[model samples]
Target: MTRVRVGCVHLLIAVSTVWVTQAQMGFVFPPVRIQAFSPRGIRVSVPDVEGITALLFDGNINKRIMYDKGDIHGFVTTKTNDYWVLDDPTVELHSGDVINYNVLLETGRFENSPILNGHFKSQQRHVVFNLERRSPPDSSLTVAESKNIKCNQSVTVVFNNNTPICSGQIIFEEDFGTLKEDVWQIEQYIPTEDPAYPFVSYQRSAVSVANMALHIAAKLQQTEPGFTSSSLYTFTLDLTDGCTGKMCKKQPSGADILPPVISGRITSKNFAFKYGTVIVRAKMPKGDWLYPEILLQPLIRNYGDTNYASGIINIASARGNEYLVANSKDYGRHVLYAGPIMDLKCREQLLQNKILVNKSWADNFHEYSLRWTPQYLTFSVDKEDWIHIEPGARGLVSRFPDNCTDLPRERLASSSELAPFDDLFHISLGLAVGGSTEFKDDLTTKADWPKPWRNSARKAMLNFWKDIDAWYPTWKQPELLIDYIKVIAL
Candidate 1:
């Protein structure tokens, strides 16, 4: 009788010994077999099993064998009484090699057993196992490299084989390459008084494009035999030179003073858009009394018209005085100004002013963008941080000050119907010097101007202009670096 016993270590423990008899020679006892058995003196086919096992007894079977050169390498076995060697005929094996094999005893269960080593000599038993390696995670890959990425815009990437790895699009872009004459005109007009900085004088010579960037520089120029920093202009008309009628009078000697600092300004006079996204990537100059501005101006400069209320959008402004008063440490140097400036009553209600309190405007290049639509306008820095303003939101009205009022009842309350902004507006980029009284003392009344807060603002501005030479570095580069300007229809 042959007996076999198999049990899990965690379940049961039983022992059974098998006795074999040779009938022809009388009774013959055989020792219990736990190891594999192979037929003696039998030459097996290449990659064919040479060994077989009847019953597995104690622990799981783990076998490691060394072989000489052979084509038969891997192995497979069924516990019912058969074992088969497996191999790929295409792969050749070398001699004197070590191979490890782990075999599970149960059909569906495997044992966590350590590997055991053994020595085997066979030239035909050596084989190789074919396995494919997996790729690493996507997070391990670097960012895509692309050359078409414009300033403030996204870009896509393609592989060397012309297969696209990633994708991006640029709607509108201007590199200021050699100044597209049809799209841009150098502003030649000098304002009698600038709305933001009244003391600034604009000059036409301050604007230029070189090295693929728009350069607007503020330099110390000789104006009226004195050295001063003034802004450049796009349009300048001598009011006294063109008039010949009785209504014309001789202009004052200092009435049309040349701007002390000559800087550059360019305007898209012929090209204007109603609603779109505008992006300007630029680096600001460093110094006191300097102002770099990116703005949108209405085609018609009238206050009474419907477009006037929404006409002006101050996308980016870096005023030295504002930076000094706000103290770049407390408030950031970037400022956004939006609202209806034509009427004081409407201005209070619609004014959407905010200071970006995080980054330094003059330290490095930054992408300043404005997303303008008929419903609302959004200002953003690097397209990450944003501020949204809806023109007709009554919640924006101010309730302070007994005499203050909201937008007029008869006026169109929504941004789409507002004048100035409703019409097409040309873009303007300029750098000016000095401070404007428009923002002075928070534009408060005389009584409020005497407060300590107002006093500190005055002192800051006074100190800036008093030690102008100390604050303004004459040798340093005095130009704003504009990498590109882009506009995309919303």
Candidate 2:
């Protein structure tokens, strides 16, 4: 009796399980199918897949689909083509389900986002189905609408079109404390990369860079959707306290001190010596939001203490230690702009020592070239005259002849000019982010700083963290594109 009862219970359980399985499998999804699209009208048909849940039609042509999961995430930008099949990702069918779908062609440039030009028609129009596409129906959403960032907090801004900034950092300053009386100091640091680290290698070093080229590019889509629209700026490269004329002259023998070029691809082995022009081309992202940068720093000796003074020299003009070189910037996207060599002619009287421009650089690439030779030095844009230094110009180098160590009378025989322009006579490429560092924001180009303020802030900054060794190093990959460098002997 017990064996029979147990057997009967097992049979009932198995039959109930089968009934539930069939019931679950019986759920049906509507399917819509399209025959073909033409200029005339639309045709419809029944879904051909069996056990199907739904039917979908992708009729938009040239539509790009960005996917996150199995579903379509968004649309990609297209240039000339329209009419694409809208991508659909969520339809799984079984053996016996059927659907019918048709499409209608679109004509002119429709203003709708996703710009739908086609329509769909199905045989069973009353059936409810979910629309399976990424993004809303409207496609005209600007970068601003996509990201909800406040403008005041945005530090890094991009210029795509007439759109507002979409992405940036909002530095929430957490005040620690001020330790000193005369000087207000904060001990906390962001622990970020110090830009002052010594540059180790460069692909190319040239005398000039091309003006009309792409300098930097950042793929913003994968980043914070905030860079959809940004403004671009263009500024003429300038160096303060620059050297030129007799004050800025170099000997042909001193070419060894020029920055060494390490190349494995070309037969030139290194940057070749040049006599005509010294142009330094660099690139920055185009548009008003990006800062166009050109910096030329002269080599100066650190006299240990009591002397934080440094003199400027022209690199192309100096033949030995105490040389100075002007650097230029040319915007290129992973490319180098070829330019002319430089010559620095001695000048007698000086007018202005710096090149100043007040225009904004946007979209177009620019070449900032400094032409220096034995006879004259000219600052130009794409070879156009921007500023010039005449022969035998007189300035600080002449007033402080004792301060100028490169002169024949000032240096001892042991202090050779051939000293690898490494320590006291070399130049550096740097961007100044003025905060509390010795580099303050000089909006007026002021010549002197208040003695107390300078001592308290600038002196303290240099004392605490000027040397590359003093600060921690942080590695960063920039967005600038660099190409092969060329050094020709003029």
Candidate 3:
């Protein structure tokens, strides 16, 4: 739990901010700003600080003071232990100026803090305080004179109909301590035998928020009142109340049956961003045919031909299979994949680089970062840039000339090389089970004890349910665990 506070002492102009994680003590955050002191001196009282004993600052080029153990060693006025006034005229701050400042908060426990500097010994200082600054805007212009004023110094980020913000500002953050419906909309529909994710039925019970994180677990379809995972018992699923898309009602046919597995998928309905850095810290799930996706989908798909025309950025993607030898290679948790998809035909061109890690990505939480800009898109794991894409002159379409032929030509409508992708995109997170298109039904993909389901067969779901004993035992804690998802302005 982090709580940051910014104090105001008569027109304190601060544009920069420093963040420090007090993993040890979690003391009340940080350097209490007390600038904007007049030459006559202003009494700045820092409240809410009970344990703080010493306060230090560079009074001027010739003077430095430290209030420690009730001993005032400065030229300023110290009425009480927590009360300080800058009576020194030489250290007065002006309206339009910049300065480097730090607040040493010695809580007695900062051995390896990121903000701690080497200048102070561990015994003397426990925390470091660095302040942010930028020249204040000119106040000479009146409301009549300021018309259509455009800010050029701030970073360009569009969201919530707000103006530009300072660089490195956290525009969006979800710690997943509690899953809020206002931020994420659950996908509740039975896409039985659909092209992309035709196997699983997304239900609310499969997902949960707990233990300071979002847990999206996959559950077996229980043979209940009206629905059954088996084909022998004919049943139907009528999800009319909370269905997200069409096909709310489905039943067992000659071959096509109800979804054998129940999983979860959530889309960010309230947030969308154009170009910025996205960081998703999550642990991949482990199970057969489990597809975990961290993606950025366009808010409005207005460029390409069909469904995936505008663009979709796959920040990070991986299968949950523990080990599966596909074409003499293991495309399991040990491998990591990242890339993009557009126009629905670029599966070969969809993936940029499939990285191989020392162990499984499902073993622990790893940071998946996407640095998106107008000119390029960079993907990184743990701050290590693994793959980056510099859009061609014809945009991403040029990368798939022969495959995605139906659309790419429409990219000429825009001047941006990253056309389609240049638009606003929303964050998406979820876990899908038993998809036909993602995992092929052939030896080339993975025989894995003769994959219970066949992609081409109409009774794919029914066939998979028949051999539940073979794969169901492998389903152990098969859920997507997300630490947090953060977005920073470029």
Candidate 4:
């Protein structure tokens, strides 16, 4: 009985081994055969076609392998002929454009329908589709409009994306290839989430070619996948003499009209109406003392030569100036803090009634919105309600008393009238330096000097040397860096 049981077990093991061998050597899935250009008539209207290589992979394969070569390459585009390859068998046709295979195996004849065994390309694998081809999207885009303008003209460009393209930035060049254009003033941004205009303007302020190039270059790239090549983004550009609506014909002596809008660079500038409230959304640099300003030029000539340059008002509490509301002379003014609870109605005769800086003036990108209707002036940073100045409310006064005339609370309130703010002019952005001529001594405290004022004084000294030396660096090179500047007209 023992011999009989042992013999039965041995027989079962032999049968199992035979079955496994047969499975491995038997039915094998065939390599997919791509029927050349369907005779039944399927047409692909690819404009440029040259070295196009087509690839396919199995859904279950550890990695999608290409037959052309054995490396990962982005999707294929052709300048002349479309390239094709037979990869996996039984591919799932998606939109007749992409194919995903479920089974991949060597070709062989079986009793009936070919099947893939448990065998795979490798024993252990990370299932990422690996491609092999030439390079990616060539650094060239179709030009929808190219005209030399003598006067400012509203230029419109409509792009047709037929294939998936890498998210790229725009650049402006002159003479078609002499690095960047001489003078191209423009602004642009992706109209993806918020409705804001991305403004790109040439910096007459920059002295270095490298620094100016950095400011002029707009770099953008796609970090997401699966975006089809046919998604088109449009741009509407208007060109005018810088600061003036008047247009010039042919690239002006100092200003040129035909500037390249390359990928990853700021687009040309677009101005809003003078009375229109300006919303500046910026990506702020670091530090607690940096009060970023969005410099803007007035649509109309500023109130003539009155040291009062026209711009929206910005409230800064830390850099020596605290914009506060006057409740009483006996009582100290209210100090505005971070968050939405802090709101002050400020209307400074010396400053415009607008939120001049974004909420992100110190840290991350923040949205700074200023509402300037005929009746009320509201300022918000990062969507947090900060302050509002009503038409009949007390105007913004200097934080510190200076040579400027001072007014008593009750008497001044009755006599003060809100100045009619009409146009916006050159948009300037800089930090408030303590010793700079722009600073008002009225807000400085001899007591606060040892702490906050001391810090400002130090920063001011450093800034002075930096600005002077920046023009002609001896050892260290200066860089022109601006993450982004946006303006909205509503």
Best by TM-score: 3
Candidate 3, backbone clash total: 0
After superposition, candidate 1 runs with Cα above 4 Å error: 1-172, 223-258, 301-310, 321-323, 326-359, 393-420, 435-439, 442-467, 474-477
In TM-score terms, candidate 2 sits at 0.26
* Per-residue accuracy of model 3 over 334-399 as CA lDDT, tens digit each: 878888776555554757556566788888899999999887889999989988887776676676
Comparing 2 with 3 on lDDT, the higher-scoring candidate is: 3
In TM-score terms, candidate 1 sits at 0.49
| C-alpha-based local distance difference test score of model 1 | 0.43
Decreasing TM-score order of the candidates:
3, 1, 4, 2
lDDT of 2 by residue, 401-480 (tens): 34333333222223322111112222122212112322222211112211111322423322322222312121022223
Error of 4 at 161 (Å): 31
Poorly placed runs, candidate 4 (over 4 Å):
1-272, 286-291, 297-302, 309-312, 315-361, 393-418, 424-426, 430-489
Lowest lDDT 10-residue stretch of candidate 4: 1-10
Q: Pick the candidate with the highest lDDT.
A: 3
Least lDDT summed over 10 consecutive residues: which range in candidate 2? 258-267
- The CA lDDT of each predicted structure is 0.43, 0.23, 0.60, 0.27
Give all TM-scores, in the order shown: 0.49, 0.26, 0.67, 0.31
The deviation in Å at residue 247 for candidate 4 is 25
In model 2, the runs with Cα more than 4 Å from the true position are 1-269, 272-274, 279-358, 361-363, 390-396, 399-409, 412-432, 435-486
